[model samples]
Target: MNEREILTNYVYKMVASLMQNGVEDVVISPGSRSTPLAYAFASTKNISIYRQVDERSAAYFALGIAKAKAKPVVLLCTSGTAAANYYPAIVEAKYARVPLIVITADRPHELREVGAPQAINQISLYGERVKWSAEFPIPDDAPMTLPYVERHIARGVSIATTAPFGPVHFNVPFREPLLIDFQEELPKQTFRNSLVGQIAPSQQAKELLTAVINETQRGFIIVGELALGTDLQQMWAFIRKLKWPVLVESLSNLRTNVPEDCGQYIVSTYDALLKSSIFKQQVAADTVIRFGAQPVSKFLTNFLTETLPTNYIVIDEDPMFRDSAAVSTHFIHTAIGEWISELSIENTVFSEEYLLKWRTSEELAAKHIQSYQEIEQDEGAVVRFLIENLPDNSDLFVSSSMPIRDIDTFLLPTKKDIQVFANRGANGIDGVMSTAIGFSEARKEREMYLLIGDLAFLHDVNALIATRYQPCKLNIIVFNNDGGGIFSYLAQSTVKEYYEDLFGTPTALSFADVAQMYEMEYMGIEDFKEVNKIMEPQKNPLRLIEIFTDRQQNVASHRKLWQRIQQELEQ
Candidate 1:
């Protein structure tokens, strides 16, 4: 066979292997060196292709798809700085445990280190951020090339989907003929059959569970962001039977869709009540069973440390040290679902009086937050309003920094089927808009809403192009505080000299102009009266509603809201 034929076979095998292993979606950023693979993927049957112009936005878009589908999404980009642009999403996938198959094209070995254009050391490029990384040999007529490509692709997919799933990288270098110009007919695709298995929890897991139930009277379950495919129903069942108060984080997607039966044990407003020293002292636990990643609430983590629960245990499938507060007494390395399921069979319930204390505090704090909404028109009120009014079966993707922090602080628990998502792995504000748009595209049938700050929205303004290409209905609510409003609550707000220039970083541009540029419908919200009309179902596919606020008032309102909750808890 000629070199072109051999290379075609290698590329075909790699794509075929990914299909066999169940990868269905590919996000491609156009580039020259990746022509062969790009055309191959585009023409392939059964795989969906999503094209994004910006490489950085494309990577995060892939991350959102992976997050929503709970499966691996492949990302294709050209060589050089194009591949480098994928670093932010790579770090997020690693920490967030989202499965991503990142493929980048490169020049042949001879082109390396000779001042070659668009050539950089592609070997081990995304070091430590990816679960595995390997460079595929330039396709040739070598006997082992076909089989090696087949096996390597299968292994890469396996690692990405296995326990502690994460991003994996494969750099494919192509020689001169980056296209199969003359194909007699496409080679019949071949597949590699690999059986993946899981290790069940041993009897020791059960024994440890018995000890936890027998020794501890006041038990608490802190549910942070769960891994993909984590059944909230099953978790709720366990928590209901265990009769323990569960502090569910916003990203856990647990604060909503709460069953009426389990509502009493679910403490959704802990961030409000936990601010008061009296409330924290009143509701301390003897044993804490934490699950998923760290909780978003700094107040909850500090409460965990101050209480110093006797048996503070954390169960995670990944080996990553999630206990940043340094309060875990035991680390159980196992699947959270499996462990919780086994523990449920014991049918042990903790103190109802302890649960009642949490219930009372949750009730009081929620009422205070609701009342604050009636009288106030601040960022906190906006968080509550958006969450409380989200369309049924829709998803809410909140930006990091002030947006997510506000959701954690004031958004009350509900029985609605609204799913909440955020990029909390690295927790940067760079790709919030793109991530939400990608998520909406992935779940095309559902309406999606993005609650983002001005800076985050401006950071990814280019992502608005995705709405035109993918055509998903996204209700973008921009809290245009004119600057980094979260900084107002930070220490830098007191730094009179450099606070406005450095930390606040105010950008006075009108989002209405931005909306017009994208041809998206724009509405400027001047007061609470306008929010109701904006919340009505939008006619256009992409709608931007800008809610303007004062940075100083935002900080003061949050402080007053916390103080109000404290007084209510005391009452």
Candidate 2:
């Protein structure tokens, strides 16, 4: 076989191994150097190929797919900045523990330091952000070429899906004549199944945990932002057995997915209640056990930090310390599922009065929120309405800044079995639209809803073009507050001299024209009543719902709500 034929065979086997090991979706940004991979994935019947033009958007698009599917999705791009565009998504995947396979096609070794076109130092480009990195050798006619590439593919997938799952970098260097239109049959070879490592606490550790549980009278469990579809059912059942009050973060999905009876134990409105000194004092926990990543609500974090519980234990699978408070008495590094399954609920029960305090506080806060909703239709109200009205088994993608904070503060506990997603790892406003679209495409069965800020929508506006081809049940509700509404509440807002230009950075662009250009169903909603029509289930695959509000008033409304909560809780 010629060198090109050898390369083609190696590529086919690598692609086949990826498919064999749970990589179903591949996102390709068209380029010459990556032609072999593009064509190989396209021809593979089991792999679904998505073509994206912008490399940056494509990377986040793949991140969304991986997040929704809870598996590794592949991304391929040409050399130079095309691979660089994958950096942001790689950082997100690393912190969020989402599995992604990033393949960057590079120039041959001889081209190094030669100032070749579309060529830069691609080795270790992603640095420590990736779980593993390797330079896949150029394809050769040697006998070992096929086995090497095949084994590399299998190992990369295994590393990505393992606990502490994240993106893996495979910088593939290809020699000239890379665009050859060669097709070859994949050899039938036995493949090893990916191995996952699991650890449970030692007998000594379990005994310590049992002692801690038995001694605590007033304790709480905080479920923070979790990996997509990380099964919390067993953990929830364990919490139920312990009968402790639970605080479910908005992105945790537990707040939305728990059964109605579970509501009596869930403190979904603690974000609002914690702002009240009276309520915070009344419901303080002696012990606090946390799972998953840090909670998104600043109030909850501050409350835990100030309370300084006697026993603060964190259960995390990753090695990184998620606690910013530095108040943790113990950090248990073990798989959450196994830890919860093995936790022995001895003859110990939490105080009913302690649990009742949290339930009453949540109920009181809910009443205040409901009253505010009846009177106003601001951004917070819009957030509440979206959460309350989301269809069962839906996917809700919230953008960072104000949108995610609003959902965390205002979203009430419900029995809805919806999956909530957000890119809170890096917490940047970039790539909101593309990420949501990719998520929608991955979950075709569920209706997808996106709550995004206008700036976030405009930052990744080009992603809208994708809907024209990969349309799904996507309803984008853009809060067009004219500027960075979150800035209005920040300390910088007090410095009015430079706030408008530097912090606010308002963009007066209208999405109506863009909507028309994209042939999307657009609705300009001024009255709160009109949102009902936009949110209702529609056969149309893509729709944009724009709601305009004043940034100044948004901040004022938020402050007023907090003040109201404080007053009600004090009463």
Candidate 3:
């Protein structure tokens, strides 16, 4: 085979291998260096390609797609800074345990450290943020590199999909004849499945569990972000039978029909919950049973560490904990589902006094919700409107800082099918809007609702630009509070002089102008009552609905809600 034929065959085989291995999506950022890989991926019918010009946005876009689909997604970018731009998403994938395959084209080894354009140490660009990294050396002769390139690509995919799955890097270096177009049929390669089998719990795990149940009167079960295929029903059944106070994070998949009166167990990741002395007291337990991934909020971690349980049993398929302060007394190395199944057969139950206290605390929280400004004609009200009006079967992607915090506290979705997503990996507000757009594109059939703050919405304004692919009907509701509304509730908001300059910096730009620039439909609402009226149904492209609120009032309203809840609890 000629040089062109070898390169073409290599690219075809790699793409084919990825598709066959269950990777269905690829986010490609256009550039000359990666032209061959991009063309090969695009021409392949089995894989879906999303075109994003900005590498940073493209990486996050791929992150969103992977996160939503619960599958490994590939990100294609050119060498140099274009590849470096994937660092943020890489860190997020590592921390959040999302599977991402990063593919970057590079210059041949001969050109390295010689000041060649777009050439830098491509190896380990992501440092320790990724699970694995490899440099595919260029062939001395084009034909020799084909098999090596094909093998490494397949290996990278496997490493990413394995347990405690995370992002993986593949740096492919090509020489002068980068543009290769050979129609020759490429031979396919099959990859060996190297699955990570779980180790059965040692005698120590069982002994530890027995000691905790014997010693502690009050035990709490807390579940965080679990993997997609997790058996939630089995776990829930175990907890319900025990009548234990179970605190569940939004992503835990355990936030189901557990009665509010069960206890002061359902913790909130919002401002009101943060200030609740009562809620804090309720969480002070003798023991805690932790399952799944880490919670997104810093407050929750602080609370867990400060109110240290005598024995904290952490159950996870992957034994690693991303949060530094999370110290486990007992680490069960088996799958959480398996552990719960075994525990359920034993028929364990907690003290009635312990269960009653939690139920009372939940009553306090419920009363608090009823007292909070009734979600009317303001920021709080807008959140309430969404909770009530969000269409059935719609997926909600909330922006960090304000939107997610609010939803976690106030807006509880009525339906279990309405999945909620956010960039809690890093909690950065930069690419939130764009990430939601990518999510909408990935799940093209379902309608997506994105709730964002004004500042976050403006950060990725360019993401709203048109693409060749048909735009997903993404309904975006922008809380136009004119600045970072969240800062007003934080301690930093007290610094009157620097508050607006640093934290609450308002852009003073109009969403209407942005809509015109992007050629998207726009709706502006001054009153919260108009939220439902404006957010009805829409077709194609994208729709932006802006709601205005007073920064001062939003803070006050949230405060009042907490106060009301406290009063109800006392009564």
Candidate 4:
């Protein structure tokens, strides 16, 4: 066979293997080197090709798609800096456990170390940033070459979508005259992946957890950032079976669509409640059961650290050493729902008073929040209005930094079933817009919203390019505080000398111009009541609703709100 057949055979098998392993979407970064791979992906059946010029945005877009669908999304980029640009998103995908198969086309082996242009040692390019990385050889005279390529594709997808799933890298070096022969239908090749069953908790582990659960009346089940497609019903059922208070993070997506009685145990206002010294002192947790990643609240983190619990247990399916407080008595790595199911104990009387205490605390803080909402038009009200106005069965992607905290604080538990997402893995502000763009692509029918700060919005503003081609109904609510508003709430704010120039890092960008440049409809508003205009999508699908806010005023308002909550809780 000629180079055409060899390349065609190899690339076709790779694409088929990806599809066989349930890869529905492929994000393509257009370049000369990746032509063959791009053409093959486009030619395939039941596959989507989202062309993105920026590799960073493309990688994050793939992350968003994989995250939303709970499936592996493939990213194709040419070698050199195009692949390097994926580093940030790769890091995010690894920590976030979002499955992404990053494929980079590289120069052939003969061109290595000879000062070849567009070639810079592509072997294991992503290093430890990816779960698995290897150099995929060009299709040649090797025996079983087609099968080998197909098998490796299967393996990579498996590794990516397994327990503690993450991004996997594949660097394929191609010679000149890269094959783009998709005119004639190539012979179909497919590989079946071995079933990856859920790893249940060991009997001994179950017995111990059950024993702890039996005695745990004053326990708290803390749910952090859960994996994508996590069943809220199962989480709620587990909470019900244990009858323990569960402090839920917004990203867990377990806080909403809860039953009416869920408010009794579901602790959404723990961020606010833990701020009160009196409430924190009164709320005692002996056996602390934890799941997912760390909580969003710094105050809650402090509470956990200060009050050392006897049985501090953490059950994570995506096993990682996330114990920041260094107080985990037993770290059981298994599926949380499975662990809860296997527990021998039913609901027993631990401390009804403890749950009552939490419920009352949440109510008090919520009351203050409500009263504050009625009086002020701060970020909390901004977030509150956004959450309250969301259509049923929608997706909300809140950016990191202030937006994440704002959503967590204001997103009350409701029956609306709003799915929330955030890049809390690395928790960086970069790629916020791109990730949301990709998320909207994956969930095409759902009403999508993005709550981002100005810096984050500008970081990946080029992501709006994807919307120009792949249009989706995305309501981007960019809270333009003119700069890093979150810094004002941190210790760096005390150093006023270098704060504004360094930490403040204000980018007084006019997002209206950005909207016009990107050809997206723009709306600017100040009054929180104007949020009522946020309604069903009409003529324009891609629109930016920019709300200008003051950084200093935001800090003052947040501290004042926290003080009021603490004062009321102390009463």
Candidate 5:
């Protein structure tokens, strides 16, 4: 076959491999260098291709799709700076553990690094942000280059989808014959599934668990974010059979069907307990069972570190503990769900005193949430409204800064099955809006909601541009408090001039203008009562609802809410 024929065949095979490997979404940014790959991807009827002219937005849109789908999503961009624009989303994916497959068309090896136009060090451009990176060389004299490229593409997709999944980069170096007709009979490419790695619980893990099973009179299991969707029912059954206390984080979907009022189960993240000295005295665990990824709160991290349990077993699919403070006394590499299913523990009665104490704590937390003020124009009220009126079965995606922290502290989802996702890995607010948009796209059937601040929304406004996939029914509730409200609430705000200019640079851009620009439906509500009225029925595709508030008042409201909680605890 001629060079053009071989290249065309290779493109066709790669697209076919991606489709076969369950890649249903593709985002393409217009550029010259990537025409062949773009054309090939567009031709695949089974795969959905979204067209985005802005490379930065396109990359984030793809990131959103992957995050929502919990599957690999492909991003195609031309060589040069177009490829470089994907860095933010790549970093987000790396930290968030979202699977994004980035395919960039590039100039050949000969044209690189010599001040060549549109040629930079494309290899490893993402640094440690990507899981794997490879540059595919154009074959000049190979008799059977089509099959080789096809095989590599299949492997690359597999590697990208494997556990501890993140972004993957493939730089295709194409020469002058980039523009080719699509009339060749493409060769078939075989898809191979990569094997996932597994590690058995260490000897220390076995010994630790055995000791806990023997001596510990009271046991508690605390499940954090990224730790749900496992067979939590079995874990629930196992713990309940032992009459052990189980504290489920809002993000940990394990609390499904387990009533918050259940004596042995407490729902909130021990937020109320953190306020009182009685918390330290009453809530002491002989053994603490921790499963899943790290929790989202600094307070929780501090509590876990300071009140170290006699025995702590960290059960995680990923062996690495992201938490520096709470290094696991025993690390279990197996899935929490799998371990719960395998363990055959008899119905052992726990001391009623431990369960009674936890139930009292639960009552205290419930009272705190009930007494939380309902006044509008404050952060506490905003959160209270969200927790009360969040649509049933709605997937909630929160921004990194204050929004998530407030949600963690104040808003506890009444519906236990609601799926909550946040980009806490790196915890940067750069791609939050785009990531939420991507998440909505992946979950098209369900209602997806994003509670973001103005700064985070402004950071990725380009993401609102046209998307190719079926746009998700997204209800974006933006807390337009002008600037970085979180920073003002922190100690850094005490610095007068520096805090005003450097930290709180409130841009006066109107959300109405942005909504008009994107042609999305917009609603600006100043009254808190109107929030539920507007958010009642969500529209398909996209809708932006801006909730206006004063930054100073929001911060004060948060403080007052905490003070109220402390008062209730003391009483």
Candidate 6:
């Protein structure tokens, strides 16, 4: 076996090991250095391969797949700047706890520091962004080479898919003559690996938590964005017995698919209810049990900080340091399943007066919100239209900044089945389109809709190129306010001189031309005329729906709604 044979066999072992470890998809960017692995991935029978022109978009695309499926997906790119392009998504994957198998094809050790083109020090390039990083030894025909490579792939997949899941890197260096003979038969290996994960609690811990729940007269369950496999039924069962309200965010994936018995006590309009400092103090809980990350609402943050609870327990399976509010009295390391079984077994459900207060507030606020029958101008109104129009079981990907803020404001936890997602880890605006495009690819049967702002839409406009090739349907509803709409809600909007130029950076590009360039169906909606019709899936895979809005009006509308709700609740 010579150099080509060594590279070919090594790539084959990697492909086989990855498949055995349950990796079904890999995203690849075109490059010469990565030809060997890319070829082998394409040739493999069980693996599905995706090709992207840009590395940045490709990485986010992989991140989206990993996030939606709650499984490890592979991202393969060439060395040099291509590997650098994956930095942003890797950072998001780390904090968001999404599993990604990052593989980069690098130049041989001899090529480094010798002024070789497309060659640089590729060792540990991603730094702390990845969970683990290792450089693959140069390909060899040694009898031991195949075994070590298989172990390497298995280790990478296991580490990535484990608790506190994140991206892991493996740099593969190859010499020249990387070509492989397609006619030759490849060796079939039987190597396989498996991993199972769950964080159960001690009996004593469960008893202590049960005592806390039973003793508290006033309490609330705070749930934010949780990873895959969170037992919502168990959570709701516990809440039903405790007779406490649950504040759920859109990213919690709890806005939909909720059991009606417990759904009656679920509070999704807390962002509005908590906005009033007076109400925040009035409805303060004596005990607060939080799960996953904090909800995307500053008012809710203020309520948690200003009205500190006596017994606040933060629960999560990941051991990473949380409790950003600094008010958590205890942190529990257990999933919702184990403890809920012990605590939610009460024969009679308590009818706490506190739950009545929450239900009343939620109803008043939601009624005021439903009064808005017109949405031709206001950006926030778009959220209401979406909540009302989007088909059941649809996937809604909200962009950071204004889009998610509005979603946190308008979305209600109910019996519908809408799943919401966002890049809230770094909270950056880049790659919004690409990530959703990847999601569309991941769940091809479900209809996908992206709620993005104008500024965020242009930031990753290159992702539109993917719409041409991706076989899934994507409906991008971009709120074209001509600039940063979120800044309009901040104090900086008071600054008239530099507001538009600095904080409110406007990009005046025609989205219709964008649709033309990408060859997508275009729809510019001014009003909610047959809004449900627009929400319906189309024959074309890609569609762009642009809504023109005034940033000032949008902010005013939000403030006005909050005030009206406050007045109604006060009355």
Q: Which candidate is the best by TM-score?
A: 4
- Kindly list the per-residue Cα lDDT of model 6 for residues 1-571, writing each as its tens digit: 6777678788877888888888999999989999988889888786788878889999999988888888899999988999999999999999888899999999999999899999988899999999899989888977787888888888889889877789999999988887875523446665555666777877777777777777777788888988665666777677666667889888987778887677777899998888776778778888898888888888888888898899998888776647877998877777778467556445233446678889988988888777654622376666887887778778999999999988888876667778899998888999888899988888877878999999889889888665555565789989888898888878888889988899988877659988888778888876546444566557567888898777788877888888888887776
Model 2 worst lDDT window (10 residues): 178-187
Instruction: Please identify model 6 stretches exceeding 4 Å from their true place.
Output: 183-191, 344-351, 374-377, 527-533, 536-539
**What TM-score goes with each of the models?**
0.96, 0.96, 0.91, 0.97, 0.91, 0.96
- Write one digit per residue (lDDT tens) for candidate 1, span 432-549: 8888888887898887889999999989987876665666678899998888998888887887998889988987876888888888888898787677766786878889999998
Could you give candidate 5's per-residue lDDT for residues 539-561 as a string of tens digits?
44578889888889887877776
Whole-structure CA lDDT of model 2? 0.83
Native-to-model Cα distance after best TM-score fit, residue 275 in candidate 4, in Å: 1.3
lDDT tens per residue, model 3, 1-571: 6777666776777787677667899999888888778878878775788888878878888888888887899999888899988887788788777889999999888888899998888888898899899887663445556566666766777778766778999888877687768443435665544344544577677666756765667777777777645666677656655556676776664544444443234543333443566666765778887777666556667777878778888876676754457656777766655555454223244566766666666655755564454553467767766765666677888998878777777644233456677887677888787788877877877768899999888887756652435355688889988899988988998879888989889878668987776667788888655667655767435788888878999888877776766665555
The C-alpha stretches of model 2 lying farther than 4 A from their native spots are: 180-185, 338-342, 347-349, 537-539
RMSD of 5: 2.8
Q: Candidate 6 local accuracy as lDDT?
A: 0.82
Listed per candidate, the RMSD to the true structure in angstroms reads: 1.8, 1.7, 3.0, 1.6, 2.8, 2.1
Q: How many backbone clashes does candidate 3 have?
A: 8
lDDT against the true structure, per candidate, is 0.84, 0.83, 0.73, 0.84, 0.72, 0.82
Global local distance difference test of model 4: 0.84
Using TM-score as the yardstick, the better of models 2 and 4 is 4
Off by over 4 Å in 4: 183-190, 346-349, 536-538
lDDT of 6 at 106: 95
Between prediction 5 and prediction 6, the one with superior TM-score is 6
Superposed by TM-score, candidate 6 places the C-alpha of residue 56 at a distance from the truth, in angstroms, of 0.2
